[model samples]
Target: MDESLLSIMEVREDLMVSPIGDSEPALRSAYFLKPIAKSLDGPVSKVLSSSMTMSLPPVFEPKDWPLVIHFDWRRHTKKKWVEWVDALQLRYKSVWKKVGIFEAIMSIKCSIAKDQNLCFGIAEKWCAETNTLLFPWGEATITLEDVMVLGGYPVVGDPVFAPLQSHEMREAEKKLILAREQLWRRTKAKASLSAWMDAFVNSGSEVEHEAFLATWLSMIGFSSKGLVSTLVFPIAVHLARGNPIALGPAVLASIYKDLTLLKNSIVGMTKQLVLGDKLELEVTLQSPFYLVQIWVWERFKNLQPQPRLINHEDPMMFRWHKVKALKIDNVRLALESAMEHFCWRPYVQYAGKFKVFYPENETLVLIDTDLDKEPTGLLVSFATCLRVSLLVGIQSTIKKYLPHRVAMQFGMDQDVPSCLPRFDGTKDFAWKNYCRPISDRSLYFPARLFEGDITTRYAKWWKRSLMGHQDFAKNMGHQDFAKNIVRRKRSPRSPQVSKANKNGNVDDDSNARKRNSDVDAPSGFLLKRLKTVSSGNSAQDGTIANESIDAYVPTCKNLSNPSSSASTAEYENVKRISPLTKLLAKDTVEPLMGRLEEDFEDANGSKESRLSSERVSLSGTQGESYTF
Candidate 1:
């Protein structure tokens, strides 16, 4: 079939996908591309069926779309349209271009294309090339690697983020949630690492423990080789005020401290990974200066292929458990530490637990140790600093947001460590991870989101897994909606009266229950009478019978009258007798209920009348105290 027959709806149906698990290795398959719009008069029909329309998105220029875009009522030929698409394909080679903002603008393009008929061509190309499917209502099941490959990028292992602004940096702290839990156990709620590090070998969190030992060992590897680096920085408590994160307690290790404890912790963790748990661990000695290893004790098979450019000439593959700087364009040096460095920075070397913005390979290169440059007020502009599974996924994102040739040159060349940290990160991981050409299918990174999509996914998974756990509902933060969900954490609200009475509390509840007992009293008789009045269709009518009041007494005399109770009971019973005839005919139930409330004094005068009746009824006589 020709492109003319492929309508937007047909394109959607073609791209419909079935979910494959993350553990499943990806493979390419043939897609049946056929024409869809059978009822169309033309390819760019203004109206297709009743809902879908022929119009281009705002991102597309008028000269690019074949349809008569109503923006200016300008139309173009199919020949011109093809040329425009060609220009776009050439200009923006990758779709990873600026994927996230406050509202993920990159993903929104897919949504717009799915909704509009004219954008079927672009949608088709994305789905086919990326090996992704576009579902109905603007959702596409895509992994970070798929977007990376579609945009002609590489997949780098161990993703981290550099947040420049305070908000974005704060958002980046989500990665610490799991680590915090480990740190808490290590610190024993004291937030004192001095105590914690003494028993580091006993720390239970396998992930953080492995990551900690691996990071320190990597540093040790570099330090032993006589190379000094300024990459690692400890994210301090005071630095993150207001929302102080639980990054455990700060362990400001010094050069003067005994190195024996540090050595024991690393050896213990490594032995645990290899011998104790019978786990096989792999580490690549990129150089004496760099060591590529797990941030924790991770399952080797569950991880994506850990390819490395061991020779940068003939690549090699390694494995592990997986989990920045600033610079200007000119002279290369480490960016000034954004957070404080309370730990020993002995000739720019670090030890113990610290946080970094990105994860680089173990073979780190430190050159021009004396060079320095000024930062040009360019801040890292990202709504979120996500720890992506594949950092390289952002590679082919069409927008190469570097400053210029000077910045790109300093950052791109792997040998130069003098440029800004963030600029270098954008290029280094992609360049280093080029182990081999992946042609079969797009390689995926287990890019877990600490802040966005992945978090929601984990929450949903928990909701399912802990289905019957009684307190799960209360912990989910949807307390108001708990009634609608599968199970509620709280018990029903019926046994309160008995519990209250047992406590010897003669509070307002007892009084209210006694006064309201009259409504419950007559309901036994009223419902039986209601059966005779109704046609048996009003299932909801029974609810009002429970609330049926005795009478609407407006004056004090009516309340004092002996026949008032009988009269009020008769009045309300009579109303129920014509429930269907009177209530349904005029549709005046709400108004009648309002009238009943307005003329009522039960709620308003009952307390006062009760207090008066309970007060001493003197009857023109004093108490039996008799003037003693």
Candidate 2:
């Protein structure tokens, strides 16, 4: 037999026949026959014994058991042993098959785990051994490689037992702690100065770079704490190399202290100045800045029984009066000319009232109230007169022909009367005097009163003209009744006219009548003659006979005649009036001149040509005289 078989038979013989198996003679004898047979095969038996000893039983079973004892030894001991040999062979084949399958499974797990960087390969080997020897199928297997993979690292193979450097690991741990500390410090600093820090941190270029870092960290399962440290390291190195972790915290703390100091200072100053009953020192020290200056000045002027200590001559205290006038003589000439040109009789009566003077300042004031009792019409006439006078006054002043600077200085101080007032106060003398009772204490005294009976005569004339009434009753010897009602003249006993006469000179009635009648009769004749001549062919004959007569005759008469002779003569006169009127009308003068030029051009070639012809005709007729 083979050496391994001989050793196996010897071990089987020893275990199959125990000393207690003497009663079983055949079994004992069979067990002794195998060892005796193995002794006879000397060299083979030794080699077989060594080889068989090296062979172990299934890891899960005892190696000392006899094959015969496990099977039936009584029946055909020799055949039974052969059968046991076949069964053992079958068991070895099955064990080999299971081991092969286990090894194949382990190989597959290792290949897969390596590719996937998983720990299952190591675990599979352990699992096979555990299944065979310990728990069999009771528990699953795990490996150190599996643990490493689960903890988020790649496992190469079985974990080798090696010593780790304690100092180096501790140093790594300190680095991580310092990184975390620096990261927290930077985060706090950024939050502390978030408003100003956004200017740098939120830059487009930096944000994109930071975003890439954040994504890379995420792929490795790094937390934000780790990423903050990694990203802020370079910034800390550049800004604060030594003790980088403390740099950001220190900066933030210092900034906070500065802000607190500023806030406290502002609060302290505000408490001292704004929350007190006393006048602010700054305002109290500056006299011009004080409110009392305005109050004192106002009281000094307005308080009754003024103290002698207050200077009356102070320019601030003196109220300058400015009186403006529309010269009556000039205004009368303008209105008369307008009436004559319109071919309308003058319905307005003038009272020979002239000369206005401010008693307080000796300032002369002249105004035109030429339109009888019609206030609006008088206002319109006054406005026209004022406009012309203003233009002339401005031109003359610019030429230094009038005291314009003095007038302007006075105007600056004079407070113009308001169009309306809340109450009849001292400022509103007209309203107070007109509306309030004379006996009332609040009645205002006029700065200057209008004297003479001009307004009374105008009011009567206006009533007559507007109502289309005649003076027949007054002429019919019922003068008293006519004056009392139709003319609205005062009753004989009323004191208004008596007072006026007392205050000023009363005109002689006979002299006034004589003067009015003479003037009226002559003016009526001249106007009638002008109208008739202007409407007839007389103007044409008159123009030919002597063109010089055109200059003396009114411009209205010349304009009425349609003949070229009359147009040419009228154009000349209008041109002469143009430059003078321009100086008086300012802005309106330009448009008027343009119209004149256009009219002259349309009539003849141009204004210059028409004027030349008229001038020649006038010069030629200068030696002759013509009757109107």
Candidate 3:
């Protein structure tokens, strides 16, 4: 505990913030990322480089793949080799940029393979062929049964929930619960109307009460089109004359029908990516704050982003695949295979990233209503509540695990760690910075958390016993760490002079830039590895079977002669992935077997990645640098 916190008074639970507790009204909740900034003179930039290009395997038609031949690696000429390499590299860059690089290159390769393989394409056919199995995507009203079955339970194999759950809604919402008001009760029903009419009610600013009026004074009629005051004016006039007998019930009933139906119309998109078919869901699970922030995807398109870095209109879809069917070690490999063939769009119109996360709170709550599909197309409940505990728990956890001194930075705040500079001063130059705003440059931490698209260790190890399946990926791994990058410092001298005197080649001219000759390589490539790609052919089982191995000897001039520079990994250093792996050509590791017998081959021959302190030169407008 912090020394300053010992002087505190009594602490109490916040009733308004609890989703599972009795609060005034049901609330809506979703996760979002908040932009933070850091100072950047020391570890200003992170680099991912490759000395050579690795070719992206071609995406074949899934149906066509089963008929194609898996040729040996000896048929192509030198020219063909170059063409293939260029094509593959281009594919890697374009695809990562297009869909967003959240996983290893190996997994991406696997996805591309699956998209082309016919066997994995069954979901689309199933969704289209059988009406009974499809999530009711085109509906206006959901049966109460559907909501109970899919959403009522917090845990299930293929669970989905939509609209408001019966028990979660406010009791006054009985107008909408025509099927059975007996299922749930409204709290203080009699006092609710009295308080609603009187101006003395302590509503505490609930979102549901935002639309409710406290008084009926505007009887002459308001000009607003969507206001209930105008629509219910006739009921007001009758009540005003002391004849408030029963019109409110009918009016509320009509509103109820619309509210229930309206909630179901705005749906959350869910799709199955072959990681595992079963989609387990949770409603308002209280979790680590960073977990939510890291899961959200941010974009730079907002010309004027809100100060808090939140977007209420933006929809986020988190797609986590469960592959308990495979060996525990093959998770990365299985994911690589899935991405090799094609990309999966879990939420097409949304700014969401797809990857995986193991569940932390994965228990089942059985509303146990046994209907398969809701008539209103709602397969799951709408998220209407957010539980942000502004208590010491969140504060301490973030402080300890993702210490504020080293947490993700967005360049908006002062006193933050150094913000990462542009690769070439272009805001969108790096994949992480793509589509990010020019002014919103920030350095995020633990690639798994801040990337907004990569999966975390929790998903990899959550509920392992329950999964009862082996890892799906046997042959996948991360690209070799980039090494030998040339990170430089800001010097008064020009690039020409700086290279000559302090840091230079044995054969350098005096005009070359002089660097501090006493600096060691900034840091070795050290990041949570969730990426995979090799400059090789597609393996038989729809995953990359071999890690791309690149061998390159750096010229003496680029080598650093360190005297006393602190290692980047120990301090504030970011890793630079050299486009190379240290694996040999002769080694071959087979992956977990697929349900169907498939062809397999060893893909090889790659590029080298050099890691060094990355030297970043501001390429665009050099505005005043902003910090935490």
Candidate 4:
């Protein structure tokens, strides 16, 4: 409610969280509660055990994971889309900026390597009750920060479903409809994706450009397969007219929705397995899940494959292009012991160097409507990272984002997050009110990368918040690790605390100057900028329509062969292992088995379990290519 209590949503020491989905309303909860200390250690926290270990549920097992049906159309069709995007970027890079999709479009240029094993492993840890991953170390989730930087979606913009108003926008929609109708007439079927591309790829009209964006959103952004859908026409029209839509939050919501689905399906399979029933259900992921794996790679350093290259000039996603993930014998065990290996603030390390997103004075503002200021710039992008708001996913799917829950991601202290109110999926809830200012100015806080600790009561409350009762703590296999924390009077990593002077400004000028110097520094090697090509016509706007698709092919480096030495070394020095290690060791599924035989010692005699290593291919039906 006030400036000093900006990042916390405090609660009473005796307060308790309600059961995850109780029918009763949450009692007397407020967005702003009693503030907690932001220090790394608080009030001599006690630990009951010397070592911590976790008990992974049945869902963590690869043997229990449901078969995934991914959209893989890229392998079947000629990649004309690549040529179209390259040509489009050259002519309309400015237009892309106006529409808030410059970064999103640029990101698709590179192909990210797929690792479904890693994706399935992380999805298993998702806690739908709190929208955070419950790991042995603490709670962490893919935040809006990850979405903005990795996925290149705009954080602040008009709602995705904002109604079209201008006559030009309506005319553009009519043009798209007519074009699709013509294609349908000739094909004697629904609009063919290939036929649609031929009709609009280089038509030179602005409407055709809008059609290109619509197809891009359907195929690349939102994952629609085969026949084209008309759902994205309105959104495309808005973009063509230079209006920025909030695709960042929308894409994030869709990712969250798909993760929840995957998590729920895994739980369902676990239940089926427990009851001795044959599992036949398959899970279909329709969102851009490569972003999910990239999120994992960015934070979990131990699990990341060595990157092929680092180019600061390109979108952040380019770093992982064609890089293969390390093959871990036990994903669950590796994740459990990865607390110290996790980079709590990865973006902070590259913030000064990344051309895509660097902090600035203007970026500190919550929201600014100045048209001259680029929407995708660090200004709006940075502000979007710190605010708590609702995300609008693809058509009808909606999710709430509570950044305050993992305030450490934004360089702030952890506290009890405001209770996210449950919403009915069947109704359109508060659709008209989404355009309101997303942040409260009174609760502004500066971003810092140094990790902060949970409030004294927050640490105690988190243990019980899982199932909404004290009994849930007894069920966890891991012990309390509060004693690992130590109080420090001053840390070089932490920003100096400053007082608000009489003029309502920070008194610490040294920290401000240091931040400015960092912002001015170059990151790594910059890529060579592409030279402009002129189309020689005002209508074409210098788009390279005649350029050959083969002239600019992007090639991927070969994946490194899986090696046991590196994978084994990470866990070789471990002193303790969880009980699940034995169960995983006995799994005879060759593909699921990692090279951990050298490290794991199963004292009990090994028992054989029949688990299938053959993954079902959905490409025959789905017909879409996978993109990271």
lDDT of 1 by residue, 1-628 (tens): 1222111000011111111111111111111111112331242122111111112132323233332211100111223322322333333323212111101111111101111221221222122211221111111222221122121111221221222346554443443334445556766644222222333323443323222322332232212222111122122211222221111000101110111222223234434544436443322221211011110001011111221111111101111111001112210010111001111011010001011111111011111111121011000100001111112211122111111111101111000001112223443443332211211110011101000011112223323323433332222211221122323221111111111123433235445455543322121011111001122221221222333222210001111112233322232222111111011121111100000000111111121211111212111223421100
Tens digits of per-residue lDDT, candidate 2, 461-518, equal: 2233223322222211112211322223221110011011232333333333343332
Pick by lDDT: 1 or 3, better one: 1
Instruction: Specify the highest-TM-score model's number.
Output: 4
- Model 3 segments beyond 4 Å from truth? 2-408, 411-476, 485-628
Question: TM-score for model 4?
Answer: 0.65
User: How good is model 2 by TM-score?
Assistant: 0.13
Clashes of each: 16, 1, 101, 7
Winner on TM-score between 2 and 4 is: 4
Score every model by TM-score.
0.15, 0.13, 0.17, 0.65
Candidate 3 structure lDDT: 0.18
**Which has the greatest lDDT?**
4
- The Cα RMSD in angstroms, rounded to one decimal, for candidate 2 relative to the true structure is 64.8
lDDT for model 1: 0.19
lDDT of 4 at 476: 38
- Which ranges in model 2 have alpha carbons more than 4 Å from their true place? 1-507, 521-576, 579-628
Model 4 lDDT per residue over 450-538, tens place? 33434545655555443243232443334454433332221123222222234544334454445444322121112121111111210
Supply the TM-score for candidate 3.
Answer: 0.17
The models' CA-based lDDT, in order, is 0.19, 0.18, 0.18, 0.51
